[model samples]
Target: MVKYLVVFEKTETGYSAYVPDLPGCIATGKTKNMTEKHIIEAIQFHIEGLIEEKIKIPISKTEADTFVFALK
Candidate 1:
Protein backbone atom coordinates (compact mmCIF):
# COMPACT_ATOMS: atom_id res chain seq x y z
CA MET A 1 0.00 0.00 0.00
CA VAL A 2 1.17 3.46 -0.82
CA LYS A 3 1.35 5.88 2.02
CA TYR A 4 0.58 9.52 1.24
CA LEU A 5 1.32 12.51 3.39
CA VAL A 6 -1.87 14.08 4.67
CA VAL A 7 -2.06 17.53 6.15
CA PHE A 8 -4.60 18.73 8.67
CA GLU A 9 -5.26 22.38 9.21
CA LYS A 10 -7.44 24.06 11.78
CA THR A 11 -9.98 26.44 10.26
CA GLU A 12 -12.26 28.98 11.84
CA THR A 13 -15.33 26.81 11.46
CA GLY A 14 -13.86 23.34 11.41
CA TYR A 15 -10.85 21.16 10.59
CA SER A 16 -9.70 20.56 7.04
CA ALA A 17 -7.34 18.00 5.54
CA TYR A 18 -5.68 17.25 2.24
CA VAL A 19 -3.20 14.85 0.74
CA PRO A 20 -0.22 16.46 -0.91
CA ASP A 21 0.57 13.55 -3.19
CA LEU A 22 -3.04 13.25 -4.32
CA PRO A 23 -4.01 16.61 -5.72
CA GLY A 24 -7.65 17.62 -5.38
CA CYS A 25 -8.21 15.05 -2.62
CA ILE A 26 -9.45 16.87 0.47
CA ALA A 27 -11.99 16.71 3.27
CA THR A 28 -13.32 18.70 6.24
CA GLY A 29 -15.06 17.87 9.48
CA LYS A 30 -16.26 19.37 12.71
CA THR A 31 -13.47 17.85 14.80
CA LYS A 32 -9.93 16.62 14.35
CA ASN A 33 -10.98 12.98 14.64
CA MET A 34 -13.77 13.48 12.16
CA THR A 35 -11.44 15.24 9.79
CA GLU A 36 -9.02 12.34 10.01
CA LYS A 37 -11.75 9.86 9.22
CA HIS A 38 -12.99 11.93 6.31
CA ILE A 39 -9.52 12.30 4.92
CA ILE A 40 -9.00 8.53 5.02
CA GLU A 41 -12.22 8.05 3.11
CA ALA A 42 -11.24 10.75 0.65
CA ILE A 43 -7.95 9.04 -0.02
CA GLN A 44 -9.61 5.70 -0.66
CA PHE A 45 -12.18 7.24 -2.97
CA HIS A 46 -9.51 9.15 -4.82
CA ILE A 47 -7.52 5.99 -5.41
CA GLU A 48 -10.57 4.07 -6.56
CA GLY A 49 -11.41 6.81 -9.03
CA LEU A 50 -7.90 6.78 -10.33
CA ILE A 51 -8.06 3.04 -10.81
CA GLU A 52 -11.39 3.28 -12.62
CA GLU A 53 -9.96 5.87 -14.97
CA LYS A 54 -6.79 3.81 -15.46
CA ILE A 55 -4.73 6.81 -14.39
CA LYS A 56 -1.30 6.29 -12.95
CA ILE A 57 -1.26 6.73 -9.19
CA PRO A 58 1.29 9.21 -8.11
CA ILE A 59 4.03 8.31 -5.66
CA SER A 60 4.39 9.88 -2.27
CA LYS A 61 7.11 12.48 -2.27
CA THR A 62 5.72 14.83 0.37
CA GLU A 63 7.30 14.95 3.79
CA ALA A 64 6.57 17.09 6.83
CA ASP A 65 8.69 18.59 9.55
CA THR A 66 8.04 20.75 12.57
CA PHE A 67 10.13 23.66 13.76
CA VAL A 68 9.87 25.65 16.94
CA PHE A 69 11.24 29.09 17.70
CA ALA A 70 11.52 31.04 20.92
CA LEU A 71 9.90 34.45 21.09
CA LYS A 72 11.31 37.12 23.27
Candidate 2:
Protein backbone atom coordinates (compact mmCIF):
# COMPACT_ATOMS: atom_id res chain seq x y z
CA MET A 1 0.00 0.00 0.00
CA VAL A 2 1.09 3.52 -0.78
CA LYS A 3 0.94 6.38 1.69
CA TYR A 4 0.26 10.04 1.02
CA LEU A 5 0.79 13.08 3.17
CA VAL A 6 -2.49 14.65 4.25
CA VAL A 7 -2.82 18.18 5.56
CA PHE A 8 -5.55 19.13 8.01
CA GLU A 9 -6.70 22.60 8.81
CA LYS A 10 -9.02 23.97 11.42
CA THR A 11 -11.78 26.16 10.03
CA GLU A 12 -14.31 28.47 11.63
CA THR A 13 -17.09 25.92 11.50
CA GLY A 14 -15.19 22.64 11.55
CA TYR A 15 -12.15 20.93 9.98
CA SER A 16 -10.86 20.40 6.45
CA ALA A 17 -8.32 18.02 4.94
CA TYR A 18 -6.56 17.39 1.66
CA VAL A 19 -4.02 15.07 0.10
CA PRO A 20 -0.93 16.85 -1.06
CA ASP A 21 0.01 14.19 -3.57
CA LEU A 22 -3.44 14.10 -5.08
CA PRO A 23 -4.78 17.41 -6.23
CA GLY A 24 -8.55 17.94 -5.96
CA CYS A 25 -8.85 15.30 -3.29
CA ILE A 26 -10.32 16.93 -0.20
CA ALA A 27 -12.81 16.49 2.60
CA THR A 28 -14.46 18.43 5.42
CA GLY A 29 -16.49 17.56 8.47
CA LYS A 30 -17.92 18.89 11.70
CA THR A 31 -15.10 17.34 13.77
CA LYS A 32 -11.54 16.19 13.34
CA ASN A 33 -12.51 12.54 13.66
CA MET A 34 -15.25 12.91 11.11
CA THR A 35 -12.96 14.79 8.76
CA GLU A 36 -10.36 12.08 9.10
CA LYS A 37 -12.88 9.44 8.14
CA HIS A 38 -14.11 11.44 5.19
CA ILE A 39 -10.58 12.08 3.98
CA ILE A 40 -9.73 8.39 4.11
CA GLU A 41 -12.75 7.62 1.97
CA ALA A 42 -11.90 10.45 -0.39
CA ILE A 43 -8.39 9.14 -0.88
CA GLN A 44 -9.69 5.69 -1.71
CA PHE A 45 -12.20 7.08 -4.15
CA HIS A 46 -9.63 9.32 -5.79
CA ILE A 47 -7.24 6.46 -6.32
CA GLU A 48 -9.96 4.24 -7.68
CA GLY A 49 -11.02 6.87 -10.15
CA LEU A 50 -7.47 7.37 -11.31
CA ILE A 51 -7.04 3.64 -11.75
CA GLU A 52 -10.24 3.42 -13.74
CA GLU A 53 -9.03 6.16 -16.02
CA LYS A 54 -5.58 4.54 -16.33
CA ILE A 55 -3.92 7.67 -15.09
CA LYS A 56 -0.60 7.56 -13.39
CA ILE A 57 -0.83 7.58 -9.63
CA PRO A 58 1.40 10.17 -8.09
CA ILE A 59 4.21 9.14 -5.77
CA SER A 60 4.13 10.36 -2.21
CA LYS A 61 7.05 12.73 -1.82
CA THR A 62 5.68 15.39 0.49
CA GLU A 63 6.85 15.34 4.10
CA ALA A 64 6.09 17.49 7.10
CA ASP A 65 7.66 18.34 10.45
CA THR A 66 7.08 20.72 13.31
CA PHE A 67 9.61 22.78 15.23
CA VAL A 68 9.13 24.65 18.45
CA PHE A 69 10.42 28.18 18.89
CA ALA A 70 11.00 30.28 21.99
CA LEU A 71 10.86 34.03 22.19
CA LYS A 72 13.38 35.90 24.24
Candidate 3:
Protein backbone atom coordinates (compact mmCIF):
# COMPACT_ATOMS: atom_id res chain seq x y z
CA MET A 1 0.00 0.00 0.00
CA VAL A 2 1.22 3.48 -0.79
CA LYS A 3 1.18 6.05 1.96
CA TYR A 4 0.14 9.44 0.66
CA LEU A 5 0.43 12.58 2.72
CA VAL A 6 -2.96 14.04 3.56
CA VAL A 7 -3.17 17.62 4.73
CA PHE A 8 -6.29 19.12 6.28
CA GLU A 9 -6.88 22.66 7.37
CA LYS A 10 -9.66 24.48 9.13
CA THR A 11 -11.28 26.98 6.83
CA GLU A 12 -13.74 29.78 7.38
CA THR A 13 -16.47 27.72 5.77
CA GLY A 14 -15.42 24.45 7.33
CA TYR A 15 -12.39 22.57 6.05
CA SER A 16 -10.47 21.59 2.96
CA ALA A 17 -7.90 18.96 1.99
CA TYR A 18 -5.10 18.28 -0.42
CA VAL A 19 -2.68 15.57 -1.28
CA PRO A 20 0.89 16.69 -1.66
CA ASP A 21 1.70 13.94 -4.11
CA LEU A 22 -0.92 15.07 -6.58
CA PRO A 23 -0.35 18.72 -7.32
CA GLY A 24 -3.28 20.93 -8.35
CA CYS A 25 -5.82 18.37 -7.20
CA ILE A 26 -7.95 20.30 -4.73
CA ALA A 27 -11.02 19.09 -2.84
CA THR A 28 -13.33 20.95 -0.52
CA GLY A 29 -16.37 20.11 1.57
CA LYS A 30 -18.84 21.69 3.92
CA THR A 31 -17.48 19.74 6.87
CA LYS A 32 -14.30 17.99 7.91
CA ASN A 33 -15.92 14.58 7.54
CA MET A 34 -17.00 15.28 4.02
CA THR A 35 -13.64 16.84 3.20
CA GLU A 36 -11.82 13.69 4.28
CA LYS A 37 -14.14 11.51 2.27
CA HIS A 38 -13.68 13.64 -0.81
CA ILE A 39 -9.93 13.60 -0.36
CA ILE A 40 -9.94 9.81 -0.51
CA GLU A 41 -11.86 9.88 -3.77
CA ALA A 42 -9.51 12.57 -5.09
CA ILE A 43 -6.49 10.47 -4.27
CA GLN A 44 -7.94 7.53 -6.15
CA PHE A 45 -8.52 9.68 -9.20
CA HIS A 46 -5.04 11.16 -8.94
CA ILE A 47 -3.45 7.73 -8.81
CA GLU A 48 -5.41 6.62 -11.86
CA GLY A 49 -4.31 9.72 -13.73
CA LEU A 50 -0.69 9.12 -12.82
CA ILE A 51 -0.87 5.54 -14.03
CA GLU A 52 -2.46 6.52 -17.32
CA GLU A 53 0.05 9.33 -17.85
CA LYS A 54 3.00 7.12 -16.86
CA ILE A 55 4.17 9.65 -14.26
CA LYS A 56 6.80 8.58 -11.77
CA ILE A 57 6.62 11.39 -9.28
CA PRO A 58 6.44 10.72 -5.57
CA ILE A 59 5.00 12.65 -2.68
CA SER A 60 7.32 14.82 -0.59
CA LYS A 61 6.70 16.77 2.55
CA THR A 62 7.97 20.04 3.99
CA GLU A 63 5.83 20.77 6.99
CA ALA A 64 5.38 24.37 8.15
CA ASP A 65 4.01 23.40 11.54
CA THR A 66 4.66 20.60 14.00
CA PHE A 67 2.39 19.18 16.65
CA VAL A 68 2.46 16.65 19.45
CA PHE A 69 -0.50 14.66 20.69
CA ALA A 70 -0.82 12.75 23.95
CA LEU A 71 -3.23 9.94 24.64
CA LYS A 72 -5.58 10.75 27.43
Ranking, lDDT, top scorer first:
2, 1, 3
Better of 1 and 2 by lDDT: 2
What is candidate 2's CA lDDT for residue 39? Answer: 100
Off by over 4 Å in 3: 57-65, 68-72
Candidate number achieving the greatest lDDT relative to the actual structure: 2
Residue 61 in model 2: lDDT: 92
TM-score of each: 0.96, 0.96, 0.75
Best by TM-score: 1
Order of candidate numbers by TM-score, starting with the best: 1, 2, 3
Candidate 3 lDDT over 18-46, as tens digits, reads 87767876789999999999999988888
* Each candidate structure's count of clashing pairs: 0, 0, 0
Q: Cα lDDT for residue 63, model 1?
A: 93
lDDT minimum window of 10 residues, candidate 2? 1-10
What would the per-residue lDDT of candidate 1 be over residues 11-63, giving only the tens digit for each residue?
99999999989999999999999999999999999999999999999999999
User: What is the Cα-based lDDT of residue 2 in candidate 3?
Assistant: 75
Q: lDDT of all predictions, in order shown?
A: 0.96, 0.97, 0.82
